[model samples]
Target: MFGWHVPAPDQAMLISGGKSRGEAGLPFRIVTGHGAFVVPVMRRVTYLTLSLMESVIEEACVTQQGIGLAVKGVIAFKVGSDQASIAAAAQRFLADQDRMSVLTGQIFAGHLRSIVGSMTVEDIIRERQKLAEQVLEASKLEMANLGLVVDSLQIQSIDDRGSGYINSLAAPHQAAIQQAAKIAQAQADQAAAEAQQASAQKQSEFARATAVKQAEYQSEIDQAQATAQQSGPLAEAKAQQAVLEEQAKVAAKNAELREAELVAEVVKPAQAEAERIRLLAQADADRTKLSAQASAAEGRIALDQAIIAQLPQMMQAAADGLANANLTILNGTDGLNDAVAQLAAQGSTILQTVMQGLAAHHDVGQQGGAGDRTDPPALGPGPDDDAAR
Candidate 1:
């Protein structure tokens, strides 16, 4: 605990006044990352920081054009990791180590002014990164003398000292930027307006198309409705027509049946009846003709018998006439003549009587129907019959 010394990762322990050659042949022995033991009061130990350090440089500089400017920059430096660099850093800044930033800032400020004096305002502003790189490069050698290494240098700012040189240089670029911004804004506005107008036109066309489609649908619906409305009556009319047709057919069939009935009930019977009456009339006509022929024959027979019955009467009349009249015959001829005349008279009388009797019988027959006609009576006895008895 008394002589044991340890250094932090970022620290270097410098042990002086009785040390071995700890490399680089320095008067002190440096310990880092481990411990070293020493004799009591004989070795003096000092710790130097090996961590990074930052220094700010602010300097008044002149450009190559002789324009005066104020320049500000930062320098980042650290003690080197080697023993010789650590020993060198310890000899210079180990008593008051925070003064490392002050010395490094002073050194970087002088170098920054000198570098700015070699360049113009345009190079300092436009090539600020290159300026910082060059300045860091230049300080690499100089910082290595103090056992330090520069990690980076940044130019914080440069002022024109109110000379208006930087403003004059940048005026044209600022105005061009403003003009470009305005042009971009105008193009964007035009594009937005065109898009809005196109949207409005599309909406209008959609509305019109919707209206047309609705109208077409409505028309179709109306036509369908009309057809539906008429269907009831049309169906009824058709039904009634069908009914009427059926009725007519039935009526026509009834008429045909009635005609057949008339033929069966009336025409057939009427024809049969007419034929019966005609047959009876024909039979009666034939019977009446036969009766008339029989009656005529009976009349002729009665006339013949009546003529024979009247012959004797007519001869008596003739004999009377002979007695009353004169008749002569010479010799026997006179007698013969009388007798012959008498016979001739007798024959003529008989003929005349036959004709008269026949006429009388015909008259009687004509007065009665054949059913009422009587046969002639048998022959009656006459005066001649009495003479014969």
Candidate 2:
């Protein structure tokens, strides 16, 4: 009494004495002549209805890792698009539902394995509906060739329990970056504060050094003024001492000049009078020399006058003797007169006869022949001769 859930072929049987053969053996007729004879009887009747719905059902006892997926789906199929393939696939694939269902489940499982490896947990959960549609479209071509169809696919839930571990591991790295940023900002602020303090200290030291220099300059000015006041009276006394020395030198020079003028007036005239007396003594010596020359000229004139008085008498006596000796002394004037007197008086009387004879022989020219006659020898002196002698 179990009614078959799948449909089967229909047939009828008729029994008389023997069975029909050939075309008559078939219970159904191609022509409409035997239709009434194959009708079902009341007690022996049977008809089976096989489903034409294209969904293939499969049951799996899978022990997989717990990915938490719950899904239900339906795929529609027909015998292939050609009639020849329809008959072949209907005979081969329709003979058992378990083999066809196992093949279709393997196709769906392959799509799920690829999606799981490539997609993250969040992507799979958020896009579950789109994931089912993509799997259904990919499985349709192979399933349809075996007279199977995919109608609709459904994804009830997708869950990722590993997301908690991913978020927990990232927290420490984020905190480390924030801590480093804060430490860098603190170092920058500290350096700026140190630089400002150093600048202020330098300005303060410069102001103190300038104040010390100004105080020293004022002290030096005060010392210079005090020294000038103490030395003023000493400089004035030295100038007065120089003026007194110049006045003493001028007074001594004036006394020397007055003494020299008195000597020139008194001594020069006395020297001129003494020179005049010496010239008068020289004139008296010249007058005595002229008086001696005049006395000597008078003595020479008297000697000459005495010699002139005796010259004529001596000349007369020389003439008389020359005449008596027959030698004529032709003395001028007085000698001639005395010689003539002697010849005239004595020569006439005493020698006249001898003179005449001498004259007569001379006149007869016999005197030239006359012999060298010697005068008679001197007779004795007469009284007159002796007396004249």
Candidate 3:
């Protein structure tokens, strides 16, 4: 392990002054990717970088038109991954590897000037990639001789050395782009303004239509209110008139009813009382007629009884007078008997006379003459008294 030599992933280890030798018969043996053993005092060891390296070249050159220009470019180069190239780079730059970028820049600077010299300033500016490719092509063999390989080349810029040539070439294109942008912006603004004007017109028309409709509606409302105002008092007056007519009908009906009530309460009762008085008077008249007839009949009966009672006393007085009479007896007994028979006949005549007188008195009383009609007339003595004397 003490005599072992190792290289980095980006480096190659070289060993010299030992039994091991390179494939190209060089003094050093190249080893990469792994370790190698060497005699510690006998072998001399070194390392060479195999990684990417950059070289920037900026140079003043003349174009084909004899115009002075400044050229700037960058080259990406590295050591070739081969035993021959590794041996060549080791023989030349192993002791001074830091100078690789400096020597590479010097090498590409000469090639950039040579390539730019064959082209005009316009050609270099318009075809910068072409210029970089040509420069890289011309330097490829020379770099390989140094054991370096060119990976890519880029032309950064080409200037006309304060002549204002590039700015003048691009001025027309910049103006065209600016003009297109201005036109597009103006079109957009015009469209927005037209749309705003159309919206404003529509709003104004709507406001006008709304105002017209509101005015018509208000007019109709006012007309209806006026009609109602005119009709109010007339309708009320008609209603009051109807009510008064009904009240009058009621009053008339009441008057008729009162008239009928008067007939029932006052007139009917007065007629009934008048009829009762007439009936009472007729009854009293009939009773008086009956009492008068009964009294007349009783008086006639009492007078007849008193007359019969007086007739018996009158017969006794006549018989006693006949007993006291003085008389001569010439056929005395026969004459006496004839006289008695004559007396009896005289009595019968006397009774007939008294009955005739009573009949005449009763007839006079029945004519309603002025007399005490309760009593009978008095009787007198009979005829035939003178013939007895």
Candidate 4:
């Protein structure tokens, strides 16, 4: 209705309890003044008031530092209590719920996205004091543009979940380094054990070879000693046998020399002496036989002479004896004949005795005389003495 009538700057309207002056692009107010004529028109004054509990759901932007954030929390603003600005805000912005509630929410959302997009989470967490002031300043301009005067601005909290995501990416590389170190240590231990085993095997082989060589050398020495021990006695026995054979040959030579000297010196002389002795014995035996015969004849002649003389005597006596016998026979014929036969036998016996005595005496003298017969002389070749005869 006020748009239809024009009021001069000097015009007065009733408000509160008195008349007040007028201005364009401002809310009308009632006023009191001195006597002036009233004019009638097709315009009237209207009044509006708001309760204390009414709130405008609008956004306010805040930039936080050190607590760097990409999402924001709740922000709140209220209209001021100043009457002049209140009247102006109510007239321009309070006409409908769409501009005050919906349109204001959209504008605040844009401001918050714009400010937070360029910041990090660390910037918001470290800069809390600076962030509260920035929210108040930005809310003042936004509220005025919506024909509202800001009474108070506040910042609640900033959200931070982006910081934890960055630290998770680097964990896998650290685990791989620890695994590689353990594998290298195991390989070094295995190499050391193999080297020790090889050294032990080589030492054992050398010791075994040395022991075998020593044993072979000892065996050869023992064989040589045994050969020397056996050979010495065999050589000594052969030398003794040779000496005995040579002694036997020398004794045989001595016996042959003794036999040859006997034949030359003694045997020939003994045989010649034996032959001369035999010749001398034959000559002596012949001489002795001739001498014996001559002596025997002489002794026989002497005995015959004596016998003849005795025979003459014997004949005479015999005659005388025979005559005596005949005379007796005449006395006794038988006695006489016996006496004659006895006398004839006695005569014949005496004659035979005389002849045998002569032969015996001849033999006695040829041998030797009766005195020489006791020991006869050696008859054969009386030494060499008969050689002269």
Better of 1 and 3 by TM-score: 1
For model 1, the superposed segments whose C-alpha errors exceed 4 Å read 213-389
What is the per-residue lDDT of model 2 for residues 1-389, given as tens digits with 9 covering 90 to 100? 23212223221122222233214343322211122233223212222112334443332211133343333345543333333333334445544645555676678766655555555444555677776777777777776666555556665444333444324444576677667777777776777777777777777777777777777777777776676676677666766766776766676677667666656765666667677777776776555444433433332233234333433433344344454555445777877677667645554454455445544533333222223222222223345642364
lDDT string for model 3 (239-343, tens) is 898899899999999998998999999989999999999999999877865666566666667767876787677667667667666666577889878887877
Number of the predicted model whose lDDT against the real structure is largest: 1
**Which stretches of model 4 miss by more than 4 angstroms?**
1-21, 24-27, 30-72, 145-147, 160-389
TM value for model 3 = 0.50
Model 4: ten consecutive residues of lowest lDDT: 373-382
TM-score of 4: 0.28
Model 1 Cα RMSD, Å?
A: 23.5
Give the TM-scores of the predictions, in the order they appear: 0.55, 0.25, 0.50, 0.28
Q: Give per-residue CA lDDT, model 4, range 215-308, as digits (tens).
A: 8778777877776677668657767767777776776776677666665666665666667777777776666677567556655565566666
Q: Indicate whether candidate 3 or candidate 4 has the larger lDDT.
A: 3
Off by over 4 Å in 3: 178-389
